[model samples]
Target chain A: MDLHLSERHLRFRDELRAWLEKNVVRPWREELRDPTASEDSLIELRRAWQKKLHAGGYLGLDWPKEWGGRGATAVEKSIFEAELVRADAPPILNFLGLSLLGPALIHHGSEEQRRRFIPPMLSADEIWCQGFSEPGAGSDLASLKTAARLEGDEFVVNGQKVWTTYGPWADWIFVLARTDAKNRYGGISFILVELRTPGVTVRPLRQITGESEFGEVFFEDARVPRANLVGQIGEGWKIAMTVLAYERGATALAYSTRYSRDLAALAHACREVGRTGPAVREKLARLVVENEVMRANGVRMLANLADGKIPGPEASMEKLFWSEFDKRFRDTAIDLLGPGGLLLRSCSEARPEVDWAREFLWSRAETIFSGSSEVQRNILAKRALSLPQEG
Target chain B: MRFELSDDQRLLRDSARDFLAAEFPLEETQRVVEHDPRGFDPAAWARLGEMGYLGLTLPAEVGGQQLGAVELAIVLEEMGRACVPGPYLDVALAAALLAAAGGRERLLAEIASGKAIVTIARQDAAFAGEAPCGIETANGKLRGRKYFVPFAAEAQALLVTTPGGVYRTDAPFAVTPLPTLDPTQRFARVDFDHVAERMAAADVVAGLEPLAAAAAAAMLLGVMSRAFEITLDYVKTRQAFGRPIGSFQALQHRLADALLRVESTRSAVYRAAWCLDNADPDAALAAASAKAYAGDAARLVCGESIQMHGGIGFTWELGLHFFLKRAKTLESHYGSTEVQLERALAAAGL
Candidate 1:
């Protein structure tokens, strides 16, 4: 009945906005803009920024207070995210760990495991990477070939994981490895493997965006302590599903604000295109309407989440819808950009290189990652709609 | 912030659904669509009048429940689901304008009681938003021909739009039904010759134009939702290729895509409705977005619903095509998606 944020939440947003505005510095801004800037320094500054956010009690807004979170309401978290986007702050360096692994651990990990992982992730002291997809296993993650064998008190892991975001920077990875190869899905186990262990080699891959934000991780006889196992050895499918559930939950829900900003910027860019044909105008106009819908839909999704049910098919549906929208949005932005679209990096203020070209390339990855649109549709068909699979 | 309906709102919506389900079954709706001259069952209008739903948004002084646009939207959604045949939207819109323009309290009560039918002959369809071309006015009397007047035969009170402003008349005027893509609603052309009525300087209808657009879109929301449910039901039960057609991935994905539009349309309409209730500055653009998206989405969902249903859907008895017709009607009722998109773009200062 009400979509307006409460006074308390608005106050929280204002406070957070003030803190972010005061803390995010000019140097960090320049570092993000300057392509030649050193990556390590940017990472360090971002890590420090996460720690600063933590020190300000801004981290883990939705986690229960007993587990070091503010126990914030879903609305507050939604507002917090909106504020973060509004400030144009650098993306939290330990994003995957904080949003994905931390929530999964909080829900499925042991008390000791939670204590061991949650704090470091909160402080950005330990970066985490996901090792679910492999070269051969993508949409069909159940067919993953990674194997982990228990030897004495350790599990020796050997596998190659592709599209591993933060692989080079991660200190640990919660990987889905086959423990019971005989049972395709039931055999998989969710194992927390440290990247520092011997045989763990992280190779960064150059992306279409020409940045190494993600990499291919090679694990050969990587030793993981038995204590690192989250839940049962053969129950990783359920645990991995939980991780995916989180991926499609608040983190997925939070993309709308950033999308709204991107859309606004694109609308601004769209006006600069001279002699725009009717086709272009129609596309631009459609994008505007869709952008508004995305914002509204995100609010609806958050409301559903607030009702205290782990989002089900709706999340997957959103995952399918928004990622597709993200790509089309960037494509339209480029189409309107004309000659400027071809520039690998746009430095012109009228059309920022990073915002347009780099973004268009990055948008290509949206559909490929986080359960591709095809996979999402399949999930909707099989799980949500209870339809039979074609095998 | 709560985005879902409240318990009270849900009750309002459910009651409307229950009433529509019982009073206006597909058979009855078909009769209304095909045979009824007024394009709706008279008894059903009386039933809604008894329930005080006709005056849902009218003020207390005017015998209305004083509920906001959200209630109207919820009721309209159920109307679409039931395929309720009537000039309900035209009536609701006319009530809104009359409430704002004032000096129509008695008429508002009649509308609230379903004792009177009123419709806004605004700029819509062939001459939508166009200032009247040959409108002749002298001594507070009007004479002109109005195009695409909704429910002209049924309405006892008509708020006709002209270049000067809005004028009201209950005096006699010639009414001629015209061919329309949609059979569930009636449209007519009215020729006016010295129909004695006073003109009023009213911007209320102009102010509520976006909301009027949004209301039309809300109807599409219901139409698509029901269409989806019907198609889904058919796909689940109707066997093809030795199994339920829904089991096919192509069909399943197509249905899912349709569901996505349906879901997004629901969101867009609700948000647009919410903007109206809260008086958000972005109301105009939000309404345009709601109208534009819902029209296109419903067409896709309704058309695909028929395609998925196959031969049975193509038949007249199936009544699936009514959704397509109704969606097509509402799509161009206030304005086509392209027209609304331009309105939105202009509102956004593009």
Candidate 2:
């Protein structure tokens, strides 16, 4: 197999490198690390970076130009992601909506819906959150209990959605609710609802990492118009599947690219701490080797994206790789950091020390999200291997 | 860039698979292991020579096919899958070093053609970047002892490292069985008292260790796939709780973790092979990193295979033990995983 990048791809990479050098705020990372700076300032910095990235035509690189995308190939998009990681750019603020919902909408949304919703998201003028997971429906998403009843032109919704990323900051939330109670999946509908609506309430849920990257959103008879439907009624399940496809494919790769860089830095730190003994060296070598594999696996999966949409089994394979690798890699870092790892993350004085202790805590949830390792495995076994459904 | 195999490489893999399936199945491999001193059938070794795989990496002038590391990896991967017993890894390594050292034209061709067998007499337990001390050259004679020597019972020539340089000896040497944890490959301790034929040009540790590490990693990839395939097959059909146990989430998740390891091993192996073939600046680092990962990769895959197969897999009749033993055996070859990791760290400038 050819491992060398094409001349055109290399050129694209160079151009993107130049753009990153110019647009990324100078000393941004050091400032982000300044423990005195408020988290709100960090959020604002990320938002501004997202705006600049969007203006630079970096977002939606694979989406059709008709939908305000750059019309880049899968490999080109992969290269963009690699460059972003190399440049140490801040995490994009609208990742959930941009990578998952934006693609799903372009695939399933009506022309009216697209025209009304696409530009605001592209500009980050309206942040979005997903309303899918509920108290009852964690992995068995089709069995969700969220219900919507039609009243004239509107659907009155009542449900509680958990793990809604960006919920606190979201201007809007794309909701999944059952329009017909008789069926688990076939009667479901996809609807978009305003987060600031009269009956909607948002509550942040703190994760083990001591930050609420996601939250829970409660809807009590929130009125959303029928026009907000993604497709016809009974299409929510299909639309959700589409969103998840992108989530586990290119989106996962983006996360992995950053994770690997962090891993490299940890390795450097390990070498600095005189931990390069046989056991430690071997552990670091394994991480380096496995990181390469994880990246290669993602690239292979990305190459197989059909019509810019990675299928369920392919995406599941990648999600399984990154989530598991992230956990093991970070834990290894924690062990390597040793006593230095014991410094609590909130202690600003320890920023000069390796910041891996925080990452080690954060990595625990990677396998729990975007489908837990169990769910991803079931998908791989049932769909990819054609195994019988586990009872 | 593509991560898939080239058209020719794919064809080579398919043909190797078919050939191994017909002539060197697991039972045949076990039979050869039990009955042969060389650890492989002489006839099969000749057949490999005829197919040009014995010298797959050598120059065409030396009667080899002159293929690169990817092809070598493809062949070795097939060999590992079938659990083929042989000194093929030794042969390939010796041929590479001899050619690199220069002025061993005749021996190179002989090894490539299967007319001669050569194995290492490692001065240390593994390739530890240092040759043994007290090696002396007196009146053009060499003296030392090499341990854990593979195929010493039948090798026509023994390659040894000394303080002066790498030396080759066709002179008589003593061979004794060194009991090993692996049944697939036999090992011996070869003692040399004034053995002759010093090859002044070769430096054994520098030229051969990297290739050896890369080959070991390639073989690990094979063991991983075979173990994964067997476990997947077993879990799919073996029923528990009135359903195929593969349907169980715990087993599924375990299988998924193993699958990830297998994929990671494949990636590392391929990249290392590519690096070696291209003579990239980072070839040594890639090889060490690959071997280190392969050590874990094989352990994880083979261990998972047994756990997935239930009690029957542990029995000798079942094939899981073969994979586990072979994987364990190869993990310490050339260098242990720990040693390889240290090499990788050193290469990374630690």
Candidate 3:
């Protein structure tokens, strides 16, 4: 029940903080602050920073040591994340691979698969995209229509995956397809396909932020090796659940920490600009509180995971809070910025826009992605509350 | 770091649930609502006291079980499920205030023995703008009005905070019972006109804020659980056009949304309670957030519970009104959702 971090954990936090201070260069910070930074520059800066993290043994702290990770404890991983955020490190393009697919592979992949995939993922030499969410199967994932048919030693896949973050640059994709359509959940199977497959195509969808960070990936007759299948055949739903847990739990921490830092920066920026209005102050204050609560909720969830307690329905609770809080904080930042918030960094007369406008637009997806708030609520009702499930 | 409840706490929760189900059912709640100063059965209070539930949060030295806030929240959820109306919230809050105020040996002892029903009047006219300070000392007397004092009509002693200090208003003070939205919980407007008082120098108001918010959050947790249950029952039984109403995606989505609110609110409330027991610095903000979130959730769930029930749910005879009244009343008590947001902002130094 105690919220204070242990002395050893505090020391670990200090060490990480010091390391980040030395190695985390400020180019990404400048890029994040300067909305004028070109998209290519931002992408390149993120990849280069991820390489620095790999060299520093901080990129995949929770992964096995054989996979080039530090093999750190949950506490250490949490500390690394907090420190990385406080240092304002660049976003990790390999997050989908390292946090989601890597863990899933470690638990469910073949030995050869692990040996081939883990190291490259840790080094950011390969970026991965998730293909669990199809155009039809969102919250009701068991109802997916994506088909993968076995043909000799390989499988031919055909489906459309929407909201594929960084799908355009991904070297590979981990997808779930219906291999046995009669069994519903049991009919599914997970497989990894190289993005360079002949029939694979990615079309980036422009976001409200004017950046196509996500894309709609279509697979038609995409051939993947049988060895790429994870776990047993027709066990894709089980594998997907494991990946979803890792994705939801890990990203909850990352997103909350990032938003907390963003809120702090916004507060400091407001103070520097001599924004004294009560509305501005009030909005800033609420964001601070929301950010703090989100942090605490993240800590509690991590604690549960560290203690070997399955996150269960409560993980969705954290997800719900994090997504909602992220939206609220970003919106509040935009409101506080007022007229200047609408101005882009390219506008010379703009009051140092600080990317708050871009961030606000991005935050709208918080509820839509990672299981819409509505879906999370349904999970909460049926699982956590033990309410009767409706047809 | 562990977020799961301890085995003892889980057992405590289960036993509390069983006790409420077997002893103080909704019928008892209805009876209390029909007759009683605080709109609760005194015999049921005695039964709970005998079960050692009254002093669940107090120290053992004061005839209590010395359980933590998590346990208190668990008990509160069960109480809310049964819709058991009483001065339980007021008593728990008073014990917390007395413990925080320090040097209240006699008062705590009396409270533990169930001989004294103590309540804190937080919403006083003078300290309405500040952190609920309401005790005053001038010519050896205390005079002020405490608004919306829960169970003031039945409370044996009142803990009043003022700018000068906190004071005990024992007797001879005017207590006027006010008609409230929730008949299950009674309220009164107390006017202290030069009442005899004992000054409590400790800043109990600040200490009591977190606990009060936690208790309110706990009550809302109960409200949500029952509302969720009622909604589920209605959706399962009530038929629409050749199907159950719950079969409709529109209603299912709304129910799911309501369920999300309830569960998240539960998490926030219990986490806040845990923090309060552990003395976390962020406890105040957490509690406020929980209160605001849970209060809103309870109101929404209760409103939807009635709506989802269709015509029967809207009737006064249907028992939905009991929960609806309590949920709506609790939304503004302790602190309004806006007040909590403001407190949270202030706590965050916004």
Candidate 4:
């Protein structure tokens, strides 16, 4: 089987690589290492990066061209991401909007909603946070208690959404709120609520990494226009499930690229410290092997996507692999580098190439946030294997 | 880009699977492993050669099909799934080495047509920390011992490795069988003190290492996959606590993790095979990574398969131990996991 990129996709990748090399003035690690960079300033830098990518016509790649997409395929999209990682470019600021909400709206929203939301979302003028997980319902997302009752011209919302990524900085939240309290899955409605709505509140939640990259959103009778509903009522669960699957296509390529960079940095760091013992070397080598295997898996996925195959529920296998490998890689990095590896990026003695301590802590969230490892395993068992569900 | 077998490769795989299931089923393999001195049926090997499997990766000019490594991996993977017993991989690798050396046309044709059996003997000792390849050739005579030579008793000749070159020495040399954990394997320590023709320089078979590792890893991919399927079937039917044990979340999650390992190994094995066939720049590193990862993944999947099967899993009658033993043997040989890790590290320049 051919794994080589087609000439057309190769051209797309080469052009994107050249563009990234020319445009990325400061790599993301350098930005992170900047002692003076605050959270807000970093976000603004990300917003500017998104604007640059949008202008380069690299955003919404794989979406229909009518909505500012590049009319590219998944192969191009995967290459774009891999190039972004290889160049160490800042992540696009509005990923939630671009990856999750944009797909949801494009597929299920009213034409009026798309007209109002799609442009600003692409331009980073309006950032969106997913309002799926809540304090009471996470792995069991359909159990969400968020309620939105339709009034004359608005839906009055009341619920607290926790682990709302980008909640602290986003202008909007696309929520899965219950419209029919009695039906578990069908009763839910997908509603987009403005943070500026009268009773909405956003409070940053301090993560173990000591950053509020995500936060909790409170909806105390927040009045969102009824016109903002994405699709017919009671169709939110179906839309959310479909949107989550969109996030899975060829992501392993991006993860492998990012991890390979860090792994190389870690290896260099080990050499600098003269930790040449066999034990440390073996650990480093194992990480290298695992990372390369991950890359193989990613390449396989990319090729399958290019072959026009839709990934099935076994996509959870990819999620399980990369997320679990992140934990192992980070843990080994810390163990190999010793105490110095635990220093925060801002610390004077910390390694400049990577914030090892922050990464070690952040990797904990990788498996937890995008469907916890346990949840993914359950999905594989029930869907991919067709094993009998718990009695 | 497609990450699947081509139509021809799929046909080869289907034929190999069908052939193995019919000719060398597990029951037959059990008998061979139990009573045969050679550890494999000679008749079955002849059939494999007749099927053009013995020369799968050799050149068409040498009486081979001129298939690529991916196709070889497909056949070996099916061989692994069937738990087919033989020195099939050993003989193919030996023939490849001979073909690479460039002076053995008649012997290569004999190998491709099932008229000869030969395997490379390189290891100087059975355990680690020993100096590799104590064997040396002086003039036309080869001397010294090689450990863990597969099917040395049955091999028509041995491609003996020296510090200076590789020599193809005829059999009737000293050979002692060294039975290990896997009864289906035929390994021996061969003492060489015979007049031997130095076929190629020491580095002539260097490229074969990656091919050997990747092929072994392909077989491991097959072994572990079959084990996973067997375990999945067992969990579905075997009841405990008034319900099917597969319904248990504890078992299901572990099975899910096993599936992840198995699928990841598939990706790594085929990618390595593809890289080698195309002579890609990443070929060495990919093959090493595939071997290292597949070894560990196979051990996990096979062990967990036995664990989930409970009592019957440990029984010899159930035949699960064959897979578990095969996995261990595969892991410890063909550039053992530790050696492959180092190779991967060196290839990556880490």
Give the interface RMSD values of the models in order: 1.8, 3.1, 3.4, 0.6
Docking class of 4: high
Among the numbered candidates, top lDDT falls to 4
**Chain A only, candidate 2, TM-score:** 0.92
Query: What digit string (tens of lDDT, one per residue) describes model 2 on residues B237-261?
Result: 9988899898887777777767767
**Which pairs of residues clash in candidate 2, taking residues 3 or more apart in a chain or in different chains?**
A390-B247
Lowest lDDT sum, 10 consecutive residues, model 1 chain B, at B123-132
Candidate 3 chain B: worst 10 consecutive residues by lDDT? B126-135
Which stretches in model 1 have alpha-carbon errors above 4 Å?
A: A27-30, A64-67, A110-115, A251-253, A273-280, A346-350, A388-391, B124-132, B196-202, B346-350
Cα error, candidate 2, residue A231 (Å) = 1.1
Ranking by lDDT: 4, 1, 2, 3
Task: Put the candidates in TM-score order, highest first.
Answer: 4, 1, 2, 3
Candidate 1 residue pairs in backbone clash: A346-A353, B123-B128, B123-B129, B124-B128
Candidate achieving the largest TM-score: 4
C-alpha displacement of B85 in model 3, angstroms? 2.2
> In candidate 2, which residue ranges exceed 4 Å CA deviation?
A251-260, A267-283, A299-314, B126-134, B200-204, B240-242
Assess each model's interface with DockQ, reporting 2 decimals per model: 0.63, 0.49, 0.31, 0.89
- Leading candidate by DockQ: 4
TM-score of each: 0.94, 0.93, 0.88, 0.99
